[model samples]
Target: MAEQGAAERGPDGLSRRRLLAASAAGGAVWLLRGTVGPESARAIGTAPVLPGGLVPYQQVYENWAGEIRTSPLWVCAPDSPQQVADLADWAAANGWRLRAQGQRHGWAPFTVAAGTPADTRVLLVDTTRSLTALSLASGFGGAGGRAVRAQTGASLEDLLAFLADQGLGVAACPAPGDLTVGGALAVGGHGTAVPAAGETPRPGQGFGSLSNQVLSLTAVVHDASAGRYVLRTFDRSEADAAAFLVHLGRAFLTEVVLRAAPDTRLRCLSRVDVPATELFAAPGSPAAGGGRTFADFLASTGRVEAIWFAFTDHPWLKTWQPAPDKPLFAHEVSAPYNYPFSDNLPQPVAELAGQLVSGSEQLAPVFGQLQFLITKIGLTGDVTDLLLAPGLLRSLLSGDTLTHLLAGGLRSDLWGASRHLLQYVRPTTLRVTANGYAIHCRRSDVQWVVSRFASSYQQVLATHQARGEYPMNGAAEIRVTGLDDPVACGVPGAQPPLLSALRPHADHPEWDTAVWLDLLTLPGTPGLHAFYREIEQELLGLFDGTRAGLRVEWSKGWAYTTDAAWADPAVLGRTVPATLRAPGAPGWDEAVATLDGYDPARVFGNPFLDALLR
Candidate 1:
């Protein structure tokens, strides 16, 4: 590989370009921000003086994938919850909207829309700065079970670690640890898990999203008598609190008290030998060969994830089983991000990824194979040539490359506290653009759902491949979890998250599980949006209301057209609300009306949210 000379090289032998490519594929925070110098970064424009002596700064706003960027945006970090309420009142008075920002790790234009004008009357309230106070709720054992009160800006890593220290933890959480508690709850983020065989869920242990664990939340809402936005606390049982549980950026939550259970050790095992065909096989089809299908694992442990690399025969399967004590053969880990190879890219993988992203669209298959090989070698420490053809192996890997990648310990089987295994993906994993959805179906139809979707995905890829169009060079990730059952929160009369993707369909009471599917790809791949649109349409049509329903994962990409995401009017106007709840029905209508009632001025909305959430 040619480089720009040693001047652009890092301390390692790899060039900066190779390092960047590797980072883009794995560990870097994919972003492009404004280049304004610090001297003027804090320069206030025509904004009125903020309350609490807060000085707003001119900053660039960009989402995780750099797909949404706005420059010269005014942002501020408040010191207290009262300051946020004051800021909201100021925004309403000054004809400006306020959007709460935390880590900015989401895909959808929930925070700020693409092509937002530099002079847009939107003020971004950054919560990660100083409003991250956390503490245990008083009288933790009353009726709500064990609980912790954390400010919205507190990171999941910190909150989970705090619970772990006290011998308490939530049953499930998102893989990334950097996500804000506020952001995760607001979007209904979830992890892969459900009840295994005859297992019982302990009190406060919910199989649904983080929002389902909320005991109470404090938010800045309108106070009719006060005639301004004021901090208000809402218990889980309140009708309005149901709307606030997963507001989708339509409201600002300053703090929340969440239910937690006693922490249990977990044993996570990884394997790369499961052929996708057999693993995703139909429920009772002989092609399954009575093999270890996705449903088989789901029934056994209830905690499983399948990562199938594009154009690959085998998918990486990880199953986490509850282990009260560490298994004798399991490697004990103390912290999260046990998969080092995934967090950091190897040289060969980085080089090929650079070429692929640089316009060698034909290299997509090769890149996919390389990624699978890396996982196989990293997980099981298998360096045998049998994994790849001799010619391709000789071309892509050498003794030097193997040595560089094998420096880390094998993570095939790991046993540790729940936090260590539950949060494995670090901020550095491949930052690809993803289109996400949740297919609701009976728990018995897990394999059926997986098989149908996988089959459609393969046909779509084959069609694109026949035309030499490789819009996806990444993988398809699938996981299964239970729906948001409010009983798990232990709050009597508590309503489910109205906007959560895992919210059980009111009409289909038997559909208990949610199959989460996300298709990942490099951000700028040609024909990507069209490819995604085809998949989205196929999914919506396939799942209709017959036996399953499809709901858009609010945090990721969706409503795709030929060129952009969140742009399909038909989807936003008709399909989405209809899927969640019948149009003009209670679930959709109630949430919208409540949110509108709280912020009648729409001071908490952006253009995109106003359109989709209307």
Candidate 2:
């Protein structure tokens, strides 16, 4: 099942029920029931019966977002496809709106209505518990390829672990471990690397956003003429395939079949306190390795990643090496997942000496505590300590928060304060900064292979130019896999490939590479959007000018403007479909049309999508 979002805490730290009650207190009476049609019943194989009468808001309050802690509603956790169909029928019959909730991980308020719908007037189908089946199937789509079918509720981390256990892995995956497969894919979550050759690139390629890497999907939708039905599609036809691959903005996905890769182990090395400007410089510079260009170093290396702490000169750099085929001792040495940063020394004086260097590491304890608090509130396991800490720092230093300063001139954001202090002590902190995560891997048949190689190389060059500084203090990671789904988003053709092709040979060795990047934004600042836009534009210009095969991950943000580039205008044409687009549906061209006139007051609409449509 998917994890729930963090809600406001009560006196005891648990979410307060009073808040939920308050959110659902005012709503009109609504009765919704489904009388299944013969065809629908046959397809669903028996309609699951639900309890009669209005479900109370208090019953469903636990599923609301933090912003709507006061919402009250009863959630019907459907157990099967049949149950979903029945609920759809009920909602249609009673004129009650139905909103699907998978893991309830989204930070937005779209999942629940503010007033009327929350008070038992609207119905919520909690799919997390309902769709718990995850399995692997072979020969389902030609021989030699494997398919991983996950019910809507599966978590990305769980799915990865499961795939790894089976000697299989996904082509690409998003960063957050707790995000639900359904939720992630719905909003177009993505993974690292660019799309491969012959692949249609999505908006953002580097982050490997959700819209890429979709093989086939099944969804239950309500239609005015046909009632409710299941829709399915595959990546056979170009337009239809691309449309289904991203879903544009259509039906809720109930199940997803992803192409899986063979399993392989990786060895990682990480270094903290690198310079930002030197990290992004071109290869062959003195500050760089001086042997091969920085890009060449990354290409020869298996994988490379960096994360920068805003307002600080030190960055973290991580590189990965494929594990040898021969066996190695399991106890070579490693840090506990709960304390990824425990053993790391303070940012090196060499990296920060001239730059801003803080006077003390006194905030380490509070930082650790805040990390614990964030995990507890988010319901993520303690295992996330390593992965989430950097993100917290990025968010805190990016000036996204309101608290600008603390008592006695301390920066409100701990990471930012540390960065400021570090710079105050070191003059080099004034240099431009670039920080984020990157991963390297052996390449394969996937289309993104070349672009992945190129981006990694480029990042290395950038690091060198900035003077040996990059971020990503954490260990580098590697995983192996055989090619599976060609239609998946991050693969070469789904959208724009993040990485570009290099070379004389189109087909190379069995090994490939995957790189990840995380750009740091200063907290309490407003330049993030501009920074991202500028960098993205520069990258696109370089790639396009050179005819490099690189593509960026669309989920982060993009420079693509054509409606057909990433969006399926058909499915997004209307608020709700006039005809239900079945699972695997390449929805209509109109689906995205209404986005041009989106209303924030309307549920399921956001500024980003609105901007995309415009």
- Top-scoring candidate (lDDT): 1
For candidate 2, lDDT tens digit of each residue in 1-614? 12122432331242223222222221010001122232342222222234343232223332222323333354566667666665555655554545666654333334542333333445566667658578885444542345677877887766776666676654345444555787776655543333323333222112234444455566554333553443443442233344333433334567776655554344434444345444544344455454332244354442344443333333344443334342242212211121112111122211221111122122322333332222222222222333455664444422311122111121111111111111111111111122222122344322233234335534543553364332221112222221222333333334221111111112322323433343422111123234344444444344332223232332222332221112224323431132222234323333343222121122222233444333
lDDT of 1: 0.85
| Clash number by candidate, in order | 5, 141
lDDT of each: 0.85, 0.37
Residue 18, model 1: lDDT of 55
Residue 502 lDDT (model 2)? 13
Q: Write the per-residue lDDT of candidate 1 for residues 315-408, one digit (tens) a residue.
A: 9999999999988889999999998878876666766766665557788898888888888888888977435555665567668667756778
Q: How far is candidate 2 from the true structure (C-alpha RMSD, Å)?
A: 15.1
Error at 19, model 1, angstroms: 8.9
